[model samples]
Target: MICPRCAASLTGKQRSGRICAHCGKRFALDPAVHGKGMHDIRIRGIAERATDHGRLKITLTQLWYLSRTRNYAWAEQDPQGVPAGIRWLVALPVAVALLLCAVLTDGVLAFVAGAAGCVVLVVASAMRHRPGRPPRSQIIPSEETFRQLMTGAWSTAYGRLPKGVVDDARPVPRPRGASRSRASAPLSRPTAVILCTDRVAALFLTANDIPGRLGAVLLEAAGTEGTAGRSDIVTGALKELAEYRSALPVVVLHDADPLGVLLAPLIRAAQPDRVVVDAGLPVSAARGKQGVVRLARHNRFADAEQLRTVAGLPEADAKWLADGFWSPIAAVPPRLLESIVVRAVERALAAPPPGPRHAHTNGFLTWPQAPQTPHARDTGRPGAGTSKREGTSSA
Candidate 1:
């Protein structure tokens, strides 16, 4: 690891204390204290990738997922079940030793040892753990810890979070019975309405003031019904917006997960006459075929079969979703996602008013700017932004 302050390579000084030997600056996150993977270099790299070289801002939660070291898939049959390979690797040596003993010594003791080995194999195979997704479970450090580390530890050490890093996880005061209002003021004719499904993405939009900058009304698929409220407010706002400016196109942003991918369709279903564009993460980026971050969750949705009928997912896509695996839109690099949403809004505005169901799935090739532009995050290091989605991963 290198000292973030002086850019000097650490020479075993950080192990004993936070003070840098070369720069003498007291750093916040000592790898010794935070774990092997937690260090200044890693954090800097993550921020760079997430923020797209300071052109975009990344949420702390999205930073949390981007900082994760492992890639995993969910198995609904057993979320906590150990992998068969692990069991075999553990028992193989013992079984081989027991067989050798039984063969070398023709005694009852050897037979008993072999029997014990068999029992050990059975115990290992039968072992069960508390049900949990390998990805995004308690075993993985909580977002709170990551938040504190960045806010309390990292900030204290570095003065503040790196450029373009936003802490979206922090709680904010909400209006009481706010949802009842259901967008009291209808949009005043923005170019388009952005309907984002994931609450995090909605928060991201607010943290960056994306709606204001783009002249769009941003709405979440959830919330604004209670507490902050519900989708009814979203529905009401859409209806009002449609009525106010019937030709105003709606841009939909969502995760690549099965349920998330269908949110655009849901919006279109409710407002059949309007033009809705989906600029959210696509399944191709989350399917692991593209080598993006595809994480697991307990997605035992009763409507598992509806993925195909509702979202037009292929058999492979449907099967992947039915397995309780998904990729969050947060996984996409912050700037790239912004560009996608922006481009989607532009597309929505340009798209002819929906005379029929004008539906299409957008991918990386059609997502953002030309290749000459800078790259945003997801992968460990900053590289050229390719036609393929960059920094694509799920927690």
Candidate 2:
């Protein structure tokens, strides 16, 4: 047996109980009494809207005319379920004839001719209909059933992108612990700084012990080495920046190539002005080295002066250069900066400070919301007397 509503297969239990599992449409089958053998099938409620509503009677009339008009007299069963229709054939000819008559006749004559023909056509079309059609449930599916015919085709064409793809492309989720109303609260101290460098740069540093030295100075200044890559550094940096009592910098150490430049801007956009710093050896110097010259072929920040201060370059950088990686830049050799480090430590010992005075929090530490442009800092601009760089250098 088949479901009268959706046409899905049904078992003996479904026919006996009047409930179809596939579409949940119910039916009532009653055996005739008094020696009669006929069983009448009555439709009950449908879980889903029925597709066959009001179709049987009109379909039967359409099929009768369609068969007679097409000369299909040998059809053994009703043509309603066999996908035949007379209007399809007549409609094309009527359209062509109307256009031809309209063109041949002029003004009022053309209008009257087309109008009379249309009236006659309408009456003839109505007269061709057959009456006393079966219920829509009894009408079968065929090529002429336009809605059912297109159902599978439409589903096959456009059902690829699921519903939630548009929603998934929305911006990153808001920080888990950030409070917008209290965005400017005082942060904790000894803020961590993680540096992400390219694998090539990592190799050079590893071979010459450059990273270990750089890590030492950075460890003294900040505290940690952050990872590189276009991952969730935003969340990590935000946590570190928010917790640091003072402004700590998160540095990105990459080659001066196109990839490094692109990565810099991404980090900038991720946190805007909040200490996602880029500290790579200038491209000019990177390209000037003998063995390392090829690595700087596509220097990304070649146009921009990446570092303005000698201290910003990791201590390991100066050591590597002085060891002969960068001897071409005639202005100032890396060895000279190494001497500056030794002298600074000597001077600091000579005037040993009374004691370390650590303040738990500053009243203005978290005053302004995240600085708008790099110029206006949480402390102050780089140019003014109130600038945060008392003994520090700006890049």
Candidate 3:
């Protein structure tokens, strides 16, 4: 057990007194709420325990299935820490016996006996409880699970759920005609465009004023055609991009998943001449992050197009895809992701002009220089021409 505030190891004295000796912070302990050793638990420790326990249970269930069915090949190759050699050693003798019985009994009786044996083995494996193992009813603390428990506990203690959680649950009432307000004026052409793989991320950026801050246009790569009236938002963004004076930098932001990795390539394919920079939640980022939630291999959310796109990826990325693990864009904290985007945009803004051959190779025209503001156009100095004359006027 450790102090949640300072990560100092908790002592027996502190545990008994309900105080963190290092941080001098007090934490409550309720036998009903925390169960045994309540004082020893940390908030993060609870979540880690829960997640580990869940994964362990799932692995055990899979192993039981493999063991009961006597699937030697799959069982031996199982990657979830199953005891492969033990499984193989147990299964081989049974398989050999089944074959020998068929030879001895001339097949018919052997089939009946094999079927009975299989059923008994499956049932027994499922029902058997090892004496030393913890019971299934034991609670495993997890961050998400603990958070939910704390929500209920807080409600009981304070007569209401936490204000943040309650507010998040309530629908935010948008002003009537808000959609019309968004569509009323044509958007100014931006210096760059950011394409997000999902609407949730795009909306998050918009809500945080990222687009205005970066002087970039934000667009969702998918679900535009399916969002009913919101399709106009996509159309308008595209229109602004098409009308931009320069070949504005087109940056692709996505999850560390297969689909996200392929977004830059997809955009490049659509407009072969444009310079598309992949601002990533790359596979490396996911691999490095301890807090990242790695989804199982063979995600249902992945489509055939995404699968095809990843086929030509580098060895490591391709292997990540084959392993069926992906980290979502949402896994990275919003602030961190925003900072990444800002840095990428700044780099693009500072880049020198692309070479003529590179820019014109695929029949795309060279990018025009950025358009000057109306004030700059008028006097060649922004806001200089519109100054009002005071008592002493300019000659």
Q: Find the candidate with the highest TM-score and give its number.
A: 1
Ranking by TM-score: 1, 3, 2
lDDT of 3 by residue, 102-153 (tens): 5678557988767655754554444422222110111123334444444554
Report the Cα lDDT for candidate 2: 0.31
Select the stronger candidate by lDDT from 1 and 3: 1
Q: Judged by lDDT relative to the true structure, which candidate is superior, 1 or 2?
A: 1
Give TM-scores for every candidate, taking all chains together and pairing residue i with residue i.
0.68, 0.21, 0.46
Which stretches of candidate 3 lie above 4 Å from their native place?
1-186, 222-246, 288-291, 297-312, 351-395
Tens-digit lDDT track of model 1 for 173-285: 23233342333333465777887767777877766666766778886666332323443544555565555355677777877765566666766777667777777776755
Pairs with backbone N, CA or C atoms under 3 Å apart (clashes), candidate 3: 46-141, 46-142, 47-142, 47-143, 50-141, 297-324
- Cα displacement (Å) at residue 322, model 1: 1.4
The lDDT of each candidate is: 0.64, 0.31, 0.45
lDDT comparing candidate 3 with the true structure: 0.45
Best by lDDT: 1
Q: What's the true lDDT of residue 156 in model 3? A: 48
